[model samples]
Target: MPPPPPTHADPPVLVIRPDSARTLGLAGDLWAFRDLLWSLADRDLRLRYRQTALGVAWVLLQPVLGALIFTFVFGVVAGLPSDGVPYFLFTFASLAGWALFAGILTRASGSLVQNSPLIAKVWFPRAVLPASTLPAALIDFLIALLLLGGMMAWAEVAPGIAILTVPLWVLALAMLALGLGLIGSALMVSYRDVQHILPVGVQLLLYASPVAYSASNVPERFLALYYLNPLAPLLEGLRASLLGTPMPPTNTIVWGATVALGTFVLGAAVFRRLERRFADVI
Candidate 1:
């Protein structure tokens, strides 16, 4: 009588289980997206060079122009001592590291907003966007390094075994840029004000850093507090490694590495946490 006893068959049961979200394995995710990362990097490279008249020449031009200006301002006008090294070579060497940091930070900070459509449409690890910028930055840094090499040769300042440590210093710079850039990327997504403020902040940071002069120029009384700025040791270490200047103390290197690593980890954590909301918000 009641639906013919349901035809003596059992009704379909919907088995609902708790939706256990899989935790992201950072290493695994990065590995999985390696190809995508390379593609994105290639795309960025092409876009950067597509319509530009100078193409890759822009890379060398930036540091060269920066060196010339700095030479005029700091070397000729201010008469800042380069610790006996030629002022042009000294400032250019420092610019090698500074440019890399600045370029990567600038690109990475704007990566999210620039790729808004991709962020909204695709479902990939957002970390790849910011990380992709490093390869191009590295390429530019290498070009600047070649110029630095020529300057050193002209100056007759041959490098020593300390040059072997150059890669480690570069790694430090990459970490610092990526870390700060990631934080900027996440913050820029929510607060558009960051888009306006970041450039000014980076400019202030450049003057605060010792790019235009030597770290030794900082008064000894403020040395302790000055080194607290992580870039101080990084720029100094790069110069020492490449040009035979005294290396930053071991403690400074350790502190710089600690700060860089901490910043990167914190940035990554924040990026991952905010990523889910990126599509909806952007």
Candidate 2:
């Protein structure tokens, strides 16, 4: 018998074409490969701690060290307000949450370039590269939260009904980080400048955000502009709810949430729109 012709019934067809289509359909595309999210996240986590002595202990130590520095500079020396909680407790709690966002953003921003070999060889959603960073970052967030809980207990800060909504505020921050990450990751594929600027930008954002300080620190004249950062109201509300301080006005919180949602949608669209060129550029 002569050579048999190769045949595959309903073979998967991935048509790589230049995209002008700006659609929110990236969700469906990414959802199809959800398993890869976990796999990639696990692989990344293992690689991160591969040869490290402390391994996961770094998670607890990282925020603790940062908090100690902030406690001395902002809490002890500067005598910043902690909304009635111990300044160490206040700064540490906020730093825990802020770390989640910053960590995710940093991972996601460089995901494409770091995984360029896989991007070129494998057929998968590029978005997975960034989305996978979330799990590892979230794991760190949970560990850090345990530290925060201990701090809260030490301070005798009993949370109220507002604490129940902490997840909502977290989701809001995650959405914003993902949105920013997608934009940065996509841009980095073609423009290397984004990679260079991202670190400085994130550092500036940390100060702009209410991580080490309270929202009330901003002068009245700048309150409106400050809340425009979206994280301002969310962080303030979170700190208040967790530490039993007063939450920001309900209107500001609602507006911040709305902005968060919009950012997510915008980021997704931008990522998908530019996703087609990733293989060529990366």
Candidate 3:
């Protein structure tokens, strides 16, 4: 007798569709894959210090060392004002926030390309990649914050009631970072130039913001335009809250919040528009 006819069953089908044609339940999908988000975040945390002798100390060292350098160069040599707080504290406070924002932006911009193999083989919310970078940045931020607390205690300088608003300012910075990261990551799938441009942009932003000096130092004529950098007011507000310096005006904080929200929405829209082509191009 001849061999029996081979059994055949239809293979499972995953009908991939363009983002425009598909209604993506982004929130739901992200919620469902919450485990993956943390997993990727954990992976990032591990990989960050995997083989380093200093381990997590690098996080503390960076802002601390930078603060010292800036204190000497800008504060001592240049006689820059520090908003009434010690220059070291002033620079450290701003550096902590800057590190968080820069870490998220840098890690997220490269996330998609770094995980190109996984992306090509799997199907999950691509947003998760950029989102995952945030946890690591937050962890670094918290570590840096602890060091700042110690420094403040040693200096006998206590945070005021405004310190309670620290988390809110952190949230605002995260929003801006994640938004820009999304835009950069999406664009990176097509343009490698973004990778080169981002570091330069970040460096420029470092000088542009009130990191090494006081926002108050900006000339009266240019102060308004300086605060236009969104990160400016947020950083100033955060430093004020931490170091008990003067708070930014209510209007400025409101403006910063609005700009952060707008940037986040714009980033999501840009990412969605380009996400469909990511797998094909990346």
A best-first ranking of the candidates according to their lDDT comes to 3, 1, 2
195 in model 1: Cα distance from truth in Å?
Answer: 1.2
Top-lDDT candidate index: 3
Give TM per candidate: 0.90, 0.91, 0.91
10 residues in a row with least lDDT, candidate 3: 5-14
Off by over 4 Å in 1: 1-24
TM for candidate 2 is 0.91
Tens digits of per-residue lDDT, candidate 2, 66-148, equal 99999999888888887788888788878877888888888899999998999888867789899999999888888878888
lDDT of each: 0.85, 0.84, 0.87
Error of 3 at 18 (Å): 5.2
State how far residue 242 of model 1 sits from its true place (Å). Answer: 0.7
Give RMSD to native, each candidate. Answer: 8.6, 3.8, 5.6
Ranking by TM-score: 3, 2, 1
